[model samples]
Target chain A: MSCWDTIADYGLRSLGIGERLLPRDNFTLCQQVTLIGSGMIWNVYFGTLAMVSGFFLATAVALGKAAQSPLLRKPSEWFIFVFRGSPLFIQFFFAYFLFLSLKQTHPIFEPFTAAWLGALIVLFLNTAAYSGEIFYGALQSIPKGDLEAADAYGFTGWNKFRRITWPTMLRLAWPAYTNEAIFLFHATALVFFSGFPAWQQRGDALYYASYFADKTFNPFIPYPILAGYFILLTLTVTGLFGLVNRRLNRHLPQQSRSKLRLRPNLLR
Target chain B: MLCYLTTGKHMAIYVSVLVVLVLLAITAVTALIFGFGGAMAARSRFLPLSWFGKGYIAIVRGVPDIAFFLFFVLALDIGFEMLRHGIKCPDWTAPIWQGNDFVVCPEAKLPLGNAPQWVHETYAFFLAVLTFSIVFGAFAANVLYGAMRAVPRAQLETAEAYGMTHRQTFWRVLVPQMWVYALPGLSNLWMVLIKATPLLFLLGIEDIVYWARELGGSKTPRFTDYPHGDWRMWYFLALLVFYLAFTRVSEIALDRIMRRLTHGQATLAGEAQRKAAT
Candidate 1:
């Protein structure tokens, strides 16, 4: 078939749309590209959803970790440690199995077995922990002067936190949090690799890329395609985060605003 | 069921833990070598070498490392086999790349067709180790390169005034001082390295993840006496706890080492130490 035919058929193939069966033999470059591009939809889906939800959860976790009460602090500390210390790959495996076992007992967990929900949950927790750590560090590092200013203005407790603490913590954490988000985005590739099956070959970008590599016995093409897609995805994430970062620093004068440069460090 | 635990295959699961540790140790050493070389090359006067080092560091920035892991293993395997094919099977002219298949002569096959199973496993393990080293080496190179630059320029100039050669100054003055600057970044890389070990399962090794899945799968009564429902959750939970404890211990140890390393250095920590000593 022509390239257009391949795109038409495999454009939404990863979502189980046009194509019922993947190209088994005589794989074309277009087929490889289209299928892998289709698969990236899942990566974008997982990364965006997890990050959007995880931001709020991570903030809550950071607050809990910094809370005065042991009741809140202890669990938050342990949650951060458990998620941060372990391999995310193992987390996915464990979560998938846990969901599977739960499915055996409860019908509500049936949807959780699917990669969209189950793997997303694992990614959610994993990013929350890493981002929570960043925010917690930022929380602790928030200048004492800022809190004192808030207290002098009669901004007590929740108001103090809302006005002074949360914004500053986020500003301090944004750079590192950007790194964590990118890391988590790259990590969505691990979902299919875990025990979580890519139902009906509807996997992520790496999945389609690996599939093509296996079928064609050529690693050069599909892997780079996947890498290129990921590169673009990471760039987009950095850009989006940079925008939020600017908003976070809007109150500061231009001379004082810390420039947001993407650092090459792994997740903090 | 008890006999299964005693068998070699089952025992291999526990052995795989050691395999991971061995992989970690070997990868750590090799990655340091690659990183050092990369840093040196990046700093070299030669343009090509500098470009190569820069490329090595930049390559990790955009791509998901799992892609590299998957790609390098197969590419390296084929590369080795292709070289052996050209050298060993000169007379055979059937194209190695015939459409979709990579059919190398039997003599060209790694470990030879009739070699023992352990050799094959060892070779695979070696490849996995190499791949891990290469990927992580780039990250380390990035860290070390920055650290090298972070060393005080005055110290290097002082070494030059003392009539030390460039190489001697680099070794004695620059390298020693760079560690203090590099420690935080390197420690972060080490944690990342520890977290990355589970990807070995993706490389198709019988690591802990492999064992967890194999043991946790539902075993029918017909298959074995130890029939059990799917218990992968529990097995993976054990693996999770093991990793958490390992990382926690590593964190504590690394923190202690940082204090020791920074005892009299010029960093903030060292300044704090000096004040406390006074």
Candidate 2:
């Protein structure tokens, strides 16, 4: 088959579309690329959903962590501690088993046993913890003058937080938040690798790359292709986050704008 | 019921904690060595060497490290065998890349197909250490590179004016001073390393995660004296507590060290120390 035919056959294979059985023989460069690219659909899905949902959770968590009341503070602190303290791999195992056992009790939780929901929940909690810490630090380090000015303007509680505190916290936390985001994106690859089973051979990019590597005994190709896709991913994340970063800092002078530096925190 | 906790396989879980600790200690040392080398390479006067260093640091930036953990174990294993095949089975004309298989001569198999089980275990462990070092080394290099730069230029210049050569200056002044700056990053890396120990399972080592699953999985009453429902949640809860406790202890220890490192230095941490002394 021509490369186009190959692409058409395996392009949506990760979503379990177009092709059923994977290319079992004569694995072409095109097939590996397409299959792996298709697999990226899962990675992107997991990363984006986890990140988007996690961001809101992270903001609440950060505020809770910074709250004055022990009722709010204690649970928030422990949540961050428990999640942050353990490896994402262990969390995946624990959650999968938790869901598996829970499924025995109720039919509603059956979906939670699958990678899409289960692993997404794990990644979501994991990123929320890490980002919550970052946001908490940012919240703590928000300039005293800013809060004072808000108070002077008769701003209080939700009004003060919305107009002043939240924006400033985001602006301060943006760089570190950018790092959390990229790492969270990378951490999505672990979803399939962990205890969560990739249903119907539908795995993420690393899953497909390993699939090809195992099939061909040629790691040189598939891994680099996956890395290429990942680098593209990293670049995309930086570029998009940079836009928000720009908007966050648009009120400030040009010289003082914090550039998004990709200092990677490798694993949670 | 308590006896179930001491079953042979359950004993492996206890041993695997030690395994995780050993991997932690060894990987930390090797990763430091790799980091030092990578940092040196990255800051070299030669353009190519510096580029190589920068590239090494940039690698983990883009790729998910689990991908590296998965890729390197297989790649390194096959790579070693292929090298041995070239050396040991020189007369064999068959290609290593047979369709859907890596057909190295049996003679070329690492630890040989017939080697003692310990040899195979040691070999696999060695590959895992190398992979961890390579990936974490890049992270450490990134840390060390910034640390080195953070060492004020004035300090290096003083060493140079004292007739210290570049190597002497680097060894005596630059490396010594960079540690203060590097400590925070290194400590964080240490926590990351601890969290990463469970990934040894992915490298095919029967580490703690392996034992957790084996011991926690529901077992039939026919197989053992103890029978229980799936207790993985409890096993994992125990594991989670182990990690959280470890993290807390490390944080305390690291805080003490950070205080010591910052005691008299001129950095912000040091400035805070000076203020507190007053």
Candidate 3:
């Protein structure tokens, strides 16, 4: 079959569209790339949803961690500790098994056994914990003068936080937080490897890459193709975050604004 | 619990914990060495070498590390076999890639085709260790490169004024001071390394994750003394707790070490220490 035929068939195969059975033999280069790229849809799905939801939880967690009340602060600290301390791989396994057990107790949780919801929840919590810590650090480092200026302006409580504190905390945290975002996207590769089963044959990019490698016994092609896709994906993540980062620092002078250095913590 | 826990495979599970620890220790030391070499290469005056070092460091940025893990295992295995094939079976060339089969002479097989199980296991473990070291070495190189630059410029200048050669200055003045700067990044990398240990299961090393899945599966009464329903959740929870505790201890230990390392340095921690002492 021609390359277009391959693309038409497996282009959206990961979403359970178009193609039903995966290529069994004579795996061509076009087939490998298309299948792996199709699998990337799941990667994007997991990363985007997790990041969107995790942001709010991370914000709450940061605020909770910074609270003076032990009731709020204690749980936040422990939550950050537990999630940050344990491996994401283990977290996926435990959550999968937990959901499995939970499904037995109630049929409502049946959806939780699937990779989309199950793995998404795991990624959400994992990124929240890590980003919460980053935001907590940023919150603490928000300049004393900024707060003083807010108080002088008669801003208090929610107004103070929204107008002064939250913005400054986010501005300070955005560079590192961008790194966390990239890291989370990279981490979505682990979903299939952990206990969560990919429903039917639909798996992520790495899954299809490995599948191709197994079939062709050529790690050279599929792995590099996967890496190439991820490089594009990473660039896309960094580029989008760069826009938000620019907005976050728009108030500061160009020289004073923080750049999104791909340094700091990444990769679990 | 005791009946199944002490069984042979389960006992191997206990031993696998040691395997994980051994992997950690070896990989850490080896990666640090690779990082040091890489950092030096990056700073070298030669352009190509510098580009190479920089590329090694940057390669980790975009890609998921698990991809690297998967790639290196097969790639390295194939690489070693090809090398062996070149040496041992020069005459036998049926095209190694004969439709998805990497055929090399029997002698080209790592640990040899007739080798014992332990030898094969050792070779596999070695490959896994090397893969971890190479991937993590790049991360360490990034950390160490920054640390090297963070050392005070005046300190290096002073060593020059004292008539020290470049090598001497780097060894005696720069390396010693860079540690304090590198400590935080290195400590973070260490925690990352600890968390990555579970990936050994993917490499087929029979590590703790392997044992957990093996022992946690429901076994009929015919299979063993104890038959239980799926206990994988408990097994995974226990593994999770082990990692959490390990990381917690490492964190506390690293914090203490940081204090000790920064005691006489010029950083903020050192300033705080001096004020407290006064």
lDDT of 2 by residue, A207-247 (tens): 99999888887899999999999999988989999999999
Q: Considering the two chains of model 1, state its CAPRI-style docking category.
A: medium
When 1 and 2 are scored with DockQ, the better candidate is 2
TM-score of every candidate relative to the true structure: 0.96, 0.97, 0.97
Badly placed stretches (over 4 Å) of model 1 are A265-268, B1-9
Tens-digit lDDT track for model 3 on A1-268?
8999999999999999997999888888899999999999999999999999999999999999999999999999999999999999999999999999899889999999999999999999999999999999999999999899889989999999888999899989998888898899999999999988888889999999998888877799999999999989988988998999999989878899778887633567
lDDT of 1 by residue, B1-278 (tens): 57756655568788989998999899999998999899989988899999999999988887888899999999999999999999998999888898988899999999788999889989889899999999989988998999999988888999999999989998989888888788888888888898899898888888888888888898899977767888889889999999998888989998999999889998888999999999
Candidate 3, B156-243: lDDT as tens digits: 9999999999999999999999999999999999999999999998888989998898888888899777888889899999999999
Chain A vs. true chain A, TM-score per candidate?
Answer: 0.96, 0.98, 0.98
User: Per-prediction DockQ scores?
Assistant: 0.72, 0.76, 0.70
Point out where model 3 deviates above 4 Å: none
User: Residue B177 lDDT in model 1?
Assistant: 87
Which 10-residue span in candidate 1 chain B carries the lowest summed lDDT?
B1-10
Tens-place lDDT per residue, model 1, A41-89, is 9999999999999999999999999999999999999999999899898
